[model samples]
Target: MKTILPFFPLNLVAFPGQELNLHVFEPRYKELVRDCVANESNFAIPSYVKNKIEYGTEMKLVNIAKEYSDGRFDIETKAINVLHVLNMQNPYKEKLYAAGDVEILTNVDNGDIILKEALFESLTELYKLVEIQKVPLNTDFRVFDIAHQIGLSKDAEYDLLQLREERQRQRFLLDHLKVILPQLRDIQKSKELIKMNGHFRHYDPLEF
Candidate 1:
């Protein structure tokens, strides 16, 4: 069934069964949050491509984590469904709230525990490299979630959001990591070479 829904365009992709914490400071989105809170309806979190793609995920407001005196909100939301936008009209043009018709997507079936485990192992190794390099990251999730964070590209993330089934999503994550790991290995090797040569930042100008 197609329904008109409130739209929030963001730079990131949200996946079903995953939690997204948002800081809502913009006035239009504050109103959008108010509307969702009042009507108990889900909001669409679509990616803002250069030309605006019509695909997005629907998220349910889980809890209002915090509220500031300035009427800003820190809220937690969970992706509940995927929606394909049929049409969009910028109703609140000043603050950028869009109204659109979206069709909910059905779930796909594709799960393999072995694949998931292998993906997790690969992700853990990647995270270890980051940690050893002292890269500033506040990664607190398990290997699977971490893989989802680092493995997915902007477009791939949008595609993952459109996937309805948990199993298919896991498989997609696995496939993503399979392709990403080799590249990560090359990056790690390059970093190690730089470190052995007195780090990239401390390299002597005359060495070139």
Candidate 2:
């Protein structure tokens, strides 16, 4: 279905089921949040990548986390669906923030169990290598829910927004893991070495 939504362009990508907390300090976005909360409306957070607005996620404003003295606000939102921009109008209807006509993109879960398990395991291991002991998992989870947690880049996360198939998203994130896990391990190893520097090392000189 197509509809118009308030647009809040951000440098970050918000994935489905992800909770995003935003500070609304700008005059435009402060008004945006107020309107959303008053009307119980959802807004689009278009990923501002490479100086251009691209694909985005539709998010429901959950609550006003806090309100500053100067009328600024801290708000919490949850990404509920993906949005494909039909077009956007800046200063929409003379309002401060931009608005967009968008089409909702639905996700297809083929339930590729093997692929899901593989991706999940790899994600867990990636966190483990970084000494993250408890990684959260939803019993019935979509790949989008964990994409941000698995170290996918903002660009890659935006790419995932375009994908409808769960298996495909899994593969996309797995590729990110393949590239990042090794680098994280190397970094961890370096950190370990740095910490061990100046520690006492008592060993036999040469036992040849």
Candidate 3:
């Protein structure tokens, strides 16, 4: 479905099911926040990267955590869904914030079990290489839930955000993890090799 969403362009890519705590400091956005809160409505944060606002997430303002004496706000927002911008207006007519006609993107969760298994293995290894003790996946988790934490670049994250299928996102991340995990392991081995007085040492510590 289509929507006329208010735009708050941010440099970071936001994903569905992710909860972000944002500090609203800008005057234009402060006005936007106050309007959304007062009207019990929501706004959109278009991903602004490489000097473009192409796609973003529809944010549901969960709580107005605090309102300062100076009209600043500390708010909690959750990314509800991904949206693609069809048209944009800077300052949205008379208002100081932008607005746009956004197309709510389709997101399907019909992924293969085998692909999910592969993802679990690859992501677990990925976290291990970073010395992170816990993998975020615990039997039943989603790719969108941890896409931002897996060393993905801004462009890659944005690419993933545009993908409409769960399986597609899974495979994209799996391929990325597969390609990067070896490089990371090699870098780790180089570090270990340096520690070993420059002797060539090969080690396999990360389980697939």
Candidate 4:
């Protein structure tokens, strides 16, 4: 069904069942937050593509993680569903928000157990390496949830968001990581070689 939702355009994509933490500082968005809190309405987060895109995810406010004295908020939200934008009457005219007719998406299945298990294993390995390298992540989830955190390119992330089948999404993620793992291993090996020489820089630079 079509609904007029308060819209927030972002540089990132949000997936169903994922949690997003946002710091809302703009006045219009603060108003949006107030409206949501008062009415329990869901908001839409569409990826901004120079021009606004017509697809996005519907988000439900979960908690106000923090509130500044200035009325800004550090809020957490969960993706409840997807939406297809039907029309944008104003096109980003709002200071910190937008409005549009978004048709809610339904019928996508939850992920399968086997795919979830495999994804967890791959993510665990990935995070172990990340931890060893001392990268920091604010929130944690199962391996499947890591897909929501890794910095996939915009188009790649949009493609992932389009996969409606749980197994298909899992397989796509597995394939994506399989391609990435080799490159990551190569980078690590190169780093190790450079470290052995006490330079702590890329080994290829030594050849120069």
Candidate that would win on lDDT? 3
User: For model 3, how does the per-residue alpha-carbon lDDT over 1-208 read when each residue is reduced to its tens digit?
Assistant: 9989888889999899999999999999999998898889889999987678888999999998999999999999999999999999988998889998999988998888999999888888888888987666786888898898889999999999999999999899988988899999999999886899967778889988
Candidate 1 displacement at residue 22 in angstroms: 2.2
In Å, residue 128's CA in model 2 sits off its true spot by: 1.9
Candidate No. with top TM-score: 3
TM-score sort, best first = 3, 2, 4, 1
Q: Which residue runs does candidate 3 get wrong by more than 4 Å?
A: 198-208
lDDT, candidate 4, 61-144, per-residue tens: 999999999999999999888778887755455435678888887645666788777766766567665554653333334333
Question: What is the clash count for each candidate, in the order shown?
Answer: 0, 0, 0, 0
Model 2 backbone overlap count = 0
lDDT of prediction 4: 0.76
- lDDT head-to-head 1 vs 4, winner: 4
Pairs that clash in candidate 4: none
Give the per-residue lDDT digits (tens) of candidate 1, residues 125-152.
Answer: 7677556555323433322244355756
Candidate 2 lDDT over 116-188, as tens digits, reads 8887788778878867778777556778767767766677777888898888887887788889888988998
Off by over 4 Å in 4: 49-51, 65-71, 91-97, 110-114, 131-144, 197-208
Candidate-wise lDDT, in order: 0.73, 0.85, 0.90, 0.76
Better of 1 and 2 by lDDT: 2
Deviating ranges (above 4 Å) for candidate 2: 182-208
Q: For all the candidates, what are their Cα RMSDs to the real structure?
A: 7.1, 3.3, 5.3, 6.4
What are the models' TM-scores?
A: 0.71, 0.84, 0.91, 0.73
User: Over the full model, what C-alpha lDDT does candidate 2 score relative to the true structure?
Assistant: 0.85
